[model samples]
Target chain A: MPTLIKHDKIMEDDWAIVEVEAPADGIRRIVPLEAWLPESGDGLLLQGECEPDARYCVAPLIAINFLVFSDGRGLSLAVLLRSRFDFTGELRAVGDVHPDLLYYLNRCGFDSYLMPDERSAQTALSTLAPYTDYYQASVLEPNPAHRRTRRFA
Target chain B: MYRYDSFDQKFVDERVVHYRAQTERYLAGELPEDEFLQLRLRNGLYIQRLAPMLRVAVPYGILDSRQLRTLAHIARHYDRGYGHLSTRQNVQFNWPELAEVPDILQDLAEVQMHAIQTSGSCIRNITTDQFAGVSEDESVDPRPYCELIRQWSTSHPEFDWLPRKFKIAVTGASVDRAAVDVHDIGLVVFRTDSDEIQFDVKVGGGLGRTPVIGQMIRRGLPVRHLLTYLEAILRVYNRYGRRDNKYKARIKILVRAMTADGFRDKVDAEWAHLEGSPSTLTDEDLARMQAHFQPYPYDSQPASIDTLGSQRLEECAFDAWVRHNVAPHKQPGYAIVTLSTKLTGVPPGDVSDVQMDLVADWADRYGFGEIRISHEQNFVLPDVRFEQLFELWQQATSAQLGANNVGLLSDMICCPGGDYCSLANAKSIPLAEAIQRKFDSYDYQHDLGPLDLNISGCMNACGHHHVGHIGILGVDKKGAEFYQVSLGGHAGNGASLGQIIGPSFSRKDVPDTIETILQVYLDLRHEDEPFLLCFRRVGMDPFKERVYANPD
Candidate 1:
């Protein structure tokens, strides 16, 4: 089982990732987006160049798989899911996830990061709070610095 | 200049702390090299061929004397006692220890400056005209908008990790001194007939291997919609921009692949969702930013001064410097002075620590204690008195900053090619030196009349060679350094890319080839016609014929 950082705490991932979709048998199975049915109530795994759809928000968890860490398309996908589609379920970042990209992943509304190891997850947790203020409106904070600060007024 | 408030200052300070931890982690071998490269790049640290180069943001070229002094201090202590002024109006220190960059950034933060977003695949520094507020032919000051864009783009959640690097340039003048058309995003600020400020938004222009002029996506967009509209464009790009091949990843390629009309429609569709969001600027927000850039207090002196006339009549060198390096100011007796960094033997934009300190002192003594770094890689003292021109000129010439070649052929914008950059195909400085030495005559160069000769080491085009009146690109031919020359590229008004001449030349032959091209221009030019006008009139056929006519 992979150790993941969720909600700023490290824990063993409980959900099982299955290649084939199954009719929800009351088991926590994460299936591919194409195979998962909305009625099954199973978590969805989004990979490759998939665009954000509000239809995917029905899943209990939506894990975005970054094929390559440097490919930033997943970050935008997460932001659109949270900011535009208002996805309230658990958002997890899996595959190519590392400590270096965790801060951005968290800011873009990823509530869970599936780490390669427990050590990497610990490093990601340690360096997560380097900033308290940000200039742009993020999924973490809908109001930007200008909207909240009185200096511009 | 917009002073950093509590929030802004805190943000930069936090960046220093964060970057310090990243550097420590990288040194400790916990972070992978590839991942650390991206992290370091976003913090404005680049692993160059020789040493790590640190780029500090100038915030649209505006710098106070105190900031300049801190830059000098950084150069003296952390670097090799000099810094290079990049074409984007930022200062880059060529040599800094990888571990010591945090200390350097800390020093920069003390003076309300930071290296954030100066590099990497993020929204880089926002740049504007060096003489934004003080120039005579200005419609509005672009600094406030530049500051606004700078803040909005800093650590932007979704857009920071883009497909490729992005650049934004703003210009408020009727004359496009900021080279907005060649940037990733260009904003032309103007006032409506009813005196309401608006922006003409241009998108997808860049100068790399594929140089495309920006297309105007929206005209007369209200000032309040600037941030939201930019967010819309960036969101569209972040989602759709190509990421498979790094070479084909710039927004220019995406815009070209999607077609300009198609891309604009997509942006409009995205913008509809973010138009009135909390990120939208209010009237108070605009006013607050504007208050920081109000006109400087000026002494009511007569428009014309007899001493300036007498000084011009007395010293021919001072007369030449004033004609070339000094520009008309909005205030009557004031002038905008460009301190030329393109001395004959020195690298074009490299300034030593002693020179930096001296220029900072001059900035305080000559103008308001403010300085501007021109994208042409020169220092501009924004508010010099006309009467004090002669005294300033004498001191400046002694310091090697008065090169009287502001727009002349010798004022070439050459990048630190193979000499410093690992990405460069050839050593550009030697070629620049050879050409400068070949065209050493001031009278001959002045006769050429306002030519932009830009050189780049590689296809990355950091030197913006694509838009030069005479563009020289260093190419690797069969593992040896060779050169390609192009003609008639312009960056202002009606911007156009240069057309490549017939073939490549050896490094030794580049200077002679430039001279032959100039000979063609001189023979074909009408009286008082500049190089670009002459080249545009005669076309590239004649110049191509003469240069290749006597092929050795």
Candidate 2:
């Protein structure tokens, strides 16, 4: 199972997220974000390294933490993770994931969006096809750039 | 006229398809509001106070009869049966639906027109003298150079996302009718001692909260290096212009922060880097663009225009119009006639559908079917025979397009402020109406002499109030609307920013304030002095003292 971290709160050893509390005894370590590489530990949760230099290594089975979706730093982070960093892990967007921003979040390569509940999560999926075409380059589609170049050429 | 070739036609056709797809995507919920806002604005669609306002670009203010008729048809079918001509020489429709904009653009593209780059942080329309090619005083036809600039600047990758919108204007004549000094970049084409056409470049001049008259940076630059030099300026602005604050984002602020000399050094450094870039203009390219704007076939006349001077003397109204509205044309028997839109009860630059159609017909009936929109918010018949003046005036008067207030106070330049714009602090159109209503008499306006009264709702100076002889600015004082009066501003061969008179006045007191200011000019003038010279002869102290001395 993919691990998830609430970026705003610190977890004690007994806090288990699935059981609504901390686990009694598991991996009892608080890894500072700078040293916590995706390859260093299995199912490790990380947050707050928005301008990561080496984000590509974490491409497999990593649950990134988004403190707030409206902050817009997360969108850039997600784009970097997908396009430049090539992170194809289970990209779950958590914390303040408004239903309105899900379309952009999905385009930026977020797979499983963590909203308030299941109904709102369905609402997020509905916003994905709001427009037909775009003029600028985006991560989800590489066709717009080609089409514009051919036309202007 | 620059006829659209296959390349130009295909480009606009493809753009229409592109915009249609974006509209579909927006309606399908794939594009978010904020993201779509940027996209639509780039296509000249603005979500104004009540509805979407579409600003249609009139490239360098030149249009033929078919284009004008197309605009009239659009106004009739899509808008409120009318359109407003803007000070930037574009036509704005106030009520285009958000979903119908793509179709609207398609219709415009059929006539070699598009709203692209009319809004957003890109190079807005490139303007030139309304009498560019036909003016007797012109050193060269500036339209070809303007067309070259348009091609170079349109959809430019590096410059599209500037800190703010940029404007460039060029004038080939010595008279400076294009108001080049108030633009972001201004070029004046003149022949050097060797008879080669050269450009004098001016940069970082604009009208806004900080109104500035541009300073000349390069003198007698050869015409070949125009695009290269422009690219240099844009690169410097894009890389270092302030983006942290929108108000301080224009190149003027950046130029001001690092004095003009320092800015010139930086631009030179940037030009050094772009010395051999592909964006540089080639002689072949210049020739190709020049071929598009070749002079029309003219039939030489047997008689000079002065032969009809005696007939105008018999009709006083036509005589006044001939003196004020007619400009010297390069052709012997022809004149550039400015048909003022500033009638007594109508808003400045507001032309109904019928009026638009009539003007289109007049263009065909008078000279070549070509028309131009002046920066002063008037229409120009670039070629009209001097003998046809009375006949054209008769038709224009019947259509309510023959107002003889071309340079008078009633012909004010106003912004669509509080009524339409979301950023306006006060209403501008109504204030303009109040001023026009007070000065409706033709005799009174004629006696007042040539005066440019400009109004802006806010300090952004969309109305270009800073360059008016009598400038009125709407100010918000503690949530209440007020008017600030200024005098001595001029825009022409000689340009200066107006100085604020004193404390602001209530909206009800504005018309009286203007009357008092005009009275001061009338009382203190020499026989030959215009309003500007009179204001300069006796400084603002006398006008300011007279205006605010009696508040009641």
Candidate 3:
């Protein structure tokens, strides 16, 4: 219904979201990791639950729900997946994705965001660009300032 | 005393800009009220009853004179020439405009300060003993560990939102001035027999409506596991602490519902995953932070008892001041001076612009230019030379900060209650002043000896009424305000919450009620028994029966 942000740009949505119990329609579709089959790995999108522990089973597209603007569970999940699992998949953040939260979400290793329109996505891009450095460690920078600098290293 | 490296400087500066943008969006009405509330709170801006009150983080209650002068300048320009030092050792400005808060934060950033995580449901300030580095009884300085926790928790990715506000207090001193029993997660850094720095971790202790002493969850946790252990604890709390009701949202409630043993199991399970991550601090990191707080070089000098005795002979007031206000410093020939902000007629912890500037000057002239804000709401010059005590006392007197009531009954811990706080049940300043007026005699207070009389306008316990020897809490009866008295609570190595004496009394009768309680202690106490000891020796029955018996 709307364009998805793939690799930081609004891209055409060819894949459709399908339930785990859906029949194999031979079309590319995003499904939960629990129901993913080896035969469907060629042209299929996959999602994981919001919980960090759910990432033991890998997926191409691990979707985490922001749920609310203030809820930080999704961001923490993304960070844990990236830093702990070294996950190299498209971490898609959907649901209640406020424009202002884009910076923190991007810092926590979310590569794609689901926004309602291209204008909102473009507007939210500016939020991710500022504050090039931070004091603490995140997915964007695995090493904290102490380790990077010789003062404490 | 922790100086900002380039990374810290950049982080704080970026936050100043980020908060400014948030303010701009808020002013444009693009962000809704509910969303802006959390965002503003993260920057320590509060929409109080009268105006916007900003609580700036004073990390571990440490500040240098330059920062103090910056605060004075902010007060003079932005506020009504005064600021309130809160129980958590942060400073609060009650009358700053919403739009100007960003500018205030910008100014604070220039001084190596930011209000990050001072409010919100995230981690608040990491507090400790005001006499952190210099206390004689402290086995080790807790500031370095506090600094470590401050950095780890600052803008942490996972814990930016929590079920409720979290607080952490650390102390290495056997005397628990940090009030470890009344915090979310309290740390006591202890050295093992082999000289390894380890921590005794306490969790789920808090002091709102349902106050519970913290349970010691982990003992002898090595220093390397500090961050991992804390991360484990916070992860457990963030994932499971109650968010359904604001009243039952603190980790204490969660720990209670899960049972402390069950909660420890959950934390241990979480720790198994997070243990020994990159967050595990190295000894080099600890040493780097420890180097910031080395004792200042002191010139060798012979004892100046004769000169001090001559000054003491000049006036009895100065002698009394030295007796109460001055404390023994860890370093020889030096003393720790507690400049009393508890002068009768002024609200406890409220310092004016001129007083701030003067105290900053004294910090520069007499000590190492560093100042400490005690949880008891007084300023501490941590390294004053004993020879200069007289001049320091004289200069402090000119600023109306010369009260000799360090541990006395008149030195009460109070909150900015109904006058400024929207959540307060009644006015606390007037009540504090009434009590101070009654107990104005220094000799009487001295005879009382090391008494803690704390007041809170509501059950929030911001005044720390739960831990005071004679705790006064304001209650609401129908439409009228009333005060309740509790006894035997002391926040120390032997920490215990005070039990309510009896039925609540009228606001006007609080001072008299306290007097009656003190009389009971005075009559029952042996020659030198403190109020707390006397109360403990003869339990709450004697005082409770006497107070309820004469329902005045």
Candidate 4:
């Protein structure tokens, strides 16, 4: 079974994201972007937008829902977020993260990738570090220009 | 040669380790054969009929003296002291042990090289004209764009698991030396009236079970939009390309099914969505990449060849070689020389360790220490001084590099067929050898004039038999090897697939069949009209009748 990480665990802060079965009366807390960020919330959780608009409320963490493992909409979204918006905030990738996709995801600039398990997450880290030099720059390493001189080194 | 930076080094080192583990897992039987094949193929390791063949990426065929030396060292130390230059402008070692491939890859990585993406359904080596940066007729050096495409395609996520292998060829020259017309995606870099560089994109062209000439989908696509456009095409192919039958999975089949117009619409729609996306190349990025491919330091010398005429006349062999092998360079006093490897008794494209080292030394001594491997399976010294041509020819001759049959009938492009390749239907190397033996005389070859005799073991067309003036395809008749002859194929500006002549001939009769076809060509020529033109004029009827008239 694929593991799921709530948006709260991804952030360095102590915030938890729980699914609301029902909306209660009085609680001063952050809500899902769909509920709170449409008009006023300063952040957004882009679910399936591969090419999201740069003019968002706040730094978006594109979520990858487990519709299909082969459906690579999240990758396009991550690349779009990095190349278009120049979004510097934590571009965390979440859900059904295949081990093979980790290298590309990291290159596309997903600092934190949410794999199905801790083992897979660890594997992702190792996989991302497999190659030391790349001819081209990705979101994570945006300066392939500097890497050319160091290609042999 | 673009030197790798620290990040590039780190990436390759990391990749080595990653592949090491993968290799280990495979050896440990942790990974299944089918799954591991994809992973191994991406690293350019292929399990052949006799042993594993490891293909090393040459990166648009651009290699420095140092890289060539490294290849020589690998050839001497690793395999059978010989390497085969492949059609994709890469080098292949035919007999590397499966267990030793990691070590071989590590050796390659030491020289800032890797066999990454040389095969598999993922993006293969991004190729361009061997004369990319130095050609006189070039509008722009296509290497930077080729490099850019290389980066974007390397380890790409969504497109890695494609329906079949994808190839992209780029050309900036008016003449398509890179054979762009017969690739999955052919990009021709051109400048508009406004002096803005743009790409004329062609799609769906390929060779194999089906031979296709790519259809142009977009014209005047600005340079900055290269990656975005490529992404659009890949996305379209990835999503809709066939997966049920491997044989029917190439983009050519998909393009045929959708029709060119329909496929273009699909790609355009995808591009529309990706217009302002991150994948969209920026001017800054293009500029930076362009900086890496700036023209080499060239000496200020007279461009005219008035002084070299007397020296060339002194040596008839040298004159013949110069006429056939030498190409005009963009820079003055320099010429692009193709060192043919199609010597009799040697497999086409096979270069020995000694030859590789000698070529490297020559590159450093005579030219700009850089070399290129042409898709027609020949090594090119892109910047040789015209005055030094005779001297270079002498050294090349001593080293057996001076075949003097560059574009001649004997200069065959052949693939390692049934002898090495598991996929081959018949032995192609022997056929090539037979043809080479028959046309051993340089005088005879020169008289025949600029004929391409290409042979492939199978329909894969790795030998590029479809584009040859005299094409020979190896076919299996029950358990016997048979050769099918074709004529009028050209891979230049006027590109066309070869037409099959008649029935397949037995191994013993193949050479005689080719001889008959040539005799017919010699008999039916109009003055100095080349083999292609004569074949076109006379049509295949004369040649076909002659070839099949005395069939064994």
Model 4 lDDT per residue over B1-552, tens place: 566666666677777888889898789986558657878998999999999899999999999998899999989988999999998999999988888888988888888899988888778998999888888899888998887887777777556667688999999999889889899999999888898999999998888888888999999899878888898898778767776687898899999999999999999987886786556677767777777877778888554676678878898888888888899888888899999887889898999999999999989988878999999899999989887788899999988889888878888889999999999999998888887888788777788887988899999889999899988898999989998888888887768899998888998898888888888888989889999999889898988777767546
TM-score of each: 0.98, 0.80, 0.94, 0.85
Can you give the DockQ of every candidate in the order shown?
0.62, 0.05, 0.38, 0.23
Count clashes in each candidate, considering only residues at least 3 apart in sequence or on different chains: 0, 15, 0, 23
TM for candidate 4 is 0.85
Model 1 interface DockQ: 0.62
Best by lDDT: 1
Better of 2 and 4 by lDDT: 4
lDDT of 2: 0.78
lDDT of 3 at B330: 82
The DockQ score of candidate 3 comes to 0.38
Report the candidate with higher DockQ, 3 versus 4: 3
Q: Assign candidate 2 its CAPRI class.
A: incorrect
- lDDT tens digits, residue span A1-153, model 1: 357898789975667678633435555888897789998988999973688899999999999998888778888889888988999999999888877677788889999988877888888888887888788788888777877767642
Off by over 4 Å in 3: A1-6, A13-56, A83-87, A116-123, A150-153
Q: Write the per-residue lDDT of candidate 2 for residues B442-541, one digit (tens) a residue.
A: 8988888989999899999888889999898989999998988888888788788999999998888999889999898889999968999999889999
Q: Which stretches of candidate 1 lie over 4 Å from their true place?
A: A20-27
Taken in order, the candidates have interface RMSDs of 1.9, 8.9, 2.9, 4.5
Residue pairs whose backbone atoms clash in candidate 1: none
lDDT per model vs. reference:
0.90, 0.78, 0.84, 0.79
**Candidate with the greatest TM-score versus the true structure:** 1
Tens digits of per-residue lDDT, candidate 4, A65-112, equal: 323334445666666676667776656555456665566666665666
Q: What digit string (tens of lDDT, one per residue) describes model 1 on residues B56-132?
A: 99999999999999999999999889999999999999999999999988999999999998999999999999999
The per-residue C-alpha lDDT of model 3 at residue B484 equals: 87
Candidate scoring better on lDDT of 3 and 4? 3
In angstroms, the error of model 4 at B343 is: 0.7
